[model samples]
Target: MKPFYIDYPQEKIAEHQHAYRCLHCKIPTTIIFGLLENHAKDCAYRIHQGRWTQLEASLKPIQKHFDEPHIDEVD
Candidate 1:
């Protein structure tokens, strides 16, 4: 899982020449700090992504266990 959420949609803040924010949550990128939880509780992007993250985590497959091949097995 990504430790930060920097890929959310963003748009220029109205009347602010150098400010931007999340399109769905309207929270400033600076405030969000690339963390999904920083978004508003009812934010569309946050809700969608939060569910996806949880689902992915729950459905993640376990790694397969295996042993290394012996040196004598080399062809």
Candidate 2:
């Protein structure tokens, strides 16, 4: 999926508070070194951000290699 980037301005809200906004949904969020990703997960416009299919497609080749059996040494 394409990355959903949040806007974090250089200025702080108060002292330790930082304001964040979703570029896709235009929703305001306040956080302090917290999980900014949670906003995107609950955002209504998350679907417009990107699709998980893109990520799956990119990982298919890597996943295929990992699926192959490997010989392990026993001591």
Candidate 3:
């Protein structure tokens, strides 16, 4: 998966409930699907700091890989 950013609360980071853990402190962080302006409230990883916006493209490629052909093969 591409590296998407999330602005999680510092307190939540302490609990570590979220799956994505902070790289620096190893604490749980939030996941932001898209880009945004301004730092989120109480977030340890603020986009304003310099964290590059990242995201995984559409899942179409993965789905197509697993999808089976509908038409019958020639005999």
Clashes of each: 0, 0, 0
- Give me the runs in candidate 1 sitting further than 4 Å from their true place: 62-75
Q: How accurate is candidate 1 locally (lDDT)?
A: 0.91
Which candidate leads in TM-score? 1
| Candidates in descending lDDT order | 1, 2, 3
Q: Pick the candidate with the highest lDDT.
A: 1
Q: What is the TM-score ranking, best to worst? A: 1, 2, 3
The 10 consecutive residues of candidate 1 with the worst lDDT sum are 66-75
Checking candidate 1 for backbone clashes, the offending pairs are none
Instruction: For residues 11-37, write the lDDT of model 3, one tens digit per residue.
Output: 434444545544434444333333232
Each model's C-alpha lDDT?
Answer: 0.91, 0.46, 0.42
Model 3 stretches with alpha carbons more than 4 Å out = 1-18, 21-30, 34-39, 47-75
Better of 1 and 2 by TM-score: 1
List TM-scores for all candidates, in order: 0.75, 0.29, 0.19
Tens digit per residue, CA lDDT, model 2, 1-75: 334344333333353355645544444554323234554565544453335545677777653345545578454
For model 2, give the 10-residue run with minimal summed lDDT. 4-13
